[model samples]
Target chain A: MSMLEKLQPIFREIFDDESIIITKQTTANDIEDWDSLTHINLIVAIEKHFNIKFALGELQSLQNVGEMLALIEEKVKKNE
Target chain B: MNEYKLKDMIVGLTQSFSVDITNEMMDLFLRLSGDNNPLHIQREFAKGMGFSDRVVYGMLTSSFYSTLAGVYLPGKYCLLTGIDVSFHKPVYVGDRLTITGEIEFISESTGQVEMKARILNQKNEKVSKSKIKFSLLE
Candidate 1:
């Protein structure tokens, strides 16, 4: 799958919104159910899927789908 | 993104700690925040208003979520990037609080980590609920 394709699943699972179609521009305001409580769950799910962990700093900086996709590529390269 | 070798920073990470809201602590919260809101500082005001005693600051309890997110979860994580919070109910002075954190998502792609979090006061009342969005590094 392409980078964006891989990312949409993670977003969908975290927000518990299967209909969630994450675009590069998608943000917190775009998702009706997105909130602090579920945010942590999203983090955990992402970590498990990538078989990697994110530093707190990186976790905080993520702003949108595009940013996350960039970081994921970086982390995958680091793992390789 | 701040990355630590888990073991090194475990001592202070996600310290899933809790404290009973003692009368003294309530006083401290009141004094520190200068939130002498009659509903929280005066017994008469509290009782007449239908509360047992002066209540504690909603933030005091919500802060536990901070400890859980900024500290634990990923373990040896970076400082929190941003946080969003909500106060649901009144937190009385003598309430017992319980807070917890568990990792559900760690995205290697965006360096974004998300967790499920909440805080509840003694009466099993949910005092605050929030979804925190933190980024890597500073």
Candidate 2:
């Protein structure tokens, strides 16, 4: 599946919104009810799925989808 | 909804946990949000702002509610369908916060449950309260 296809379920599960459609530039502010706790829940779900643990700094530094994709790329490379 | 089910949850499930406020914990939360409110970073600024010292982030206390949900309910049990939170008072450094929650309502068919959550200081001062709702399953 493409990255967007993969990220869709993460959005749906974390925000409990099956209607969520995440674009490359999607940010938390774009979605209602995407608060901090839910953000952590999303992080935990993503980590579980990809089996990559995120550093506190990486999690804190993520501002949008581009940053998330970059971080995922870096994490995937490190693991490889 | 089974009256016995709600009573059983209240009697056997609800629990309370306490955590003391510290500068380290405060700074961790501040760092996470990049919230550098001088009132939270400096004692004099806090006092000047009518507070004794740095106060806890309102969301920090709210997060504790998640801790409670994760522990008592466990796993996806906290389908936590909905929630509404309100900040009532400020938590200060050195305050011992006791987070307490109780089951208020349950609808088995609808798969919805309502809970009342509260954060109180050692002195029993209410710091925050919320009406939280969750689903028993997906």
Candidate 3:
């Protein structure tokens, strides 16, 4: 599966909504429950799912799903 | 308002201030935030959840970051845009918290600075930490 397809389930699980569709442009403002607290939870969940870690600084610079996907792709490649 | 131009801000600029957490302050914060979580308002509930007393709201403690950025660090002519904080420990009533902020980075193009912020309790334990970003209003 593509990275975005793999990420879909994680986002759905974190937000507890299966119908949530995400694209490169999707951001916190697009979701009702994506506040700071949930943002941390989502980060943790993503890290666990992908078996990678994100630095606080790195997490801060990611403004949208596209940036996140790029980071994940980079990290997943490095691990292989 | 203290006039602080973009040229005036430099990395390593720091500020520290203290606040005493009181019952009245907690009550006022609770009312203002409309966050009536039992962990913060009910002592018995807090104790049942393993705390000695009702825990102070984390946001209440984190709000000091705003005071640091707005009133002290870049002081006046400051516009706080964002804050990212992590709560490390519970803040109890009557805890005296010393909040410190240090400039970490300054974006020349945006005139926005990122500050490393921390709150230490009376016992010198870190209760929370944050990165606060703000811009100097021209």
Best prediction by DockQ:
1
Candidate 3 per-residue lDDT over residues A1-80, each given as its tens digit = 98999999999987989999999899999999898655755776677688776654777778899999999999888889
Candidate 2 docking category? Answer: incorrect
Cα displacement (Å) at residue B44, model 3: 0.9
lDDT of 2 by residue, A1-80 (tens): 87668878988977888988888899988999888656655765666577676764556767897788778777778888
lDDT of candidate 3 over B46-83, digit per residue (tens)? 99999999999999998888888778888887878768
Winner on DockQ between 2 and 3 is 3
Error of 1 at B79 (Å): 1.3
lDDT of 1 by residue, B1-91 (tens): 1244323322223434466777887677777788788877788888887877766677777767766665554444554655678788878
lDDT of 3 at B128: 99
Can you tell me the CAPRI class of model 1?
incorrect
By TM-score, rank the candidates, best first: 3, 2, 1
Off by over 4 Å in 1: A1-80, B1-16, B74-76, B135-138
Interface RMSD of every predicted model, in angstroms: 7.0, 13.3, 10.2
Per-model DockQ:
0.17, 0.02, 0.05
Cα-based lDDT at residue A7, candidate 2: 75
Best by lDDT: 3
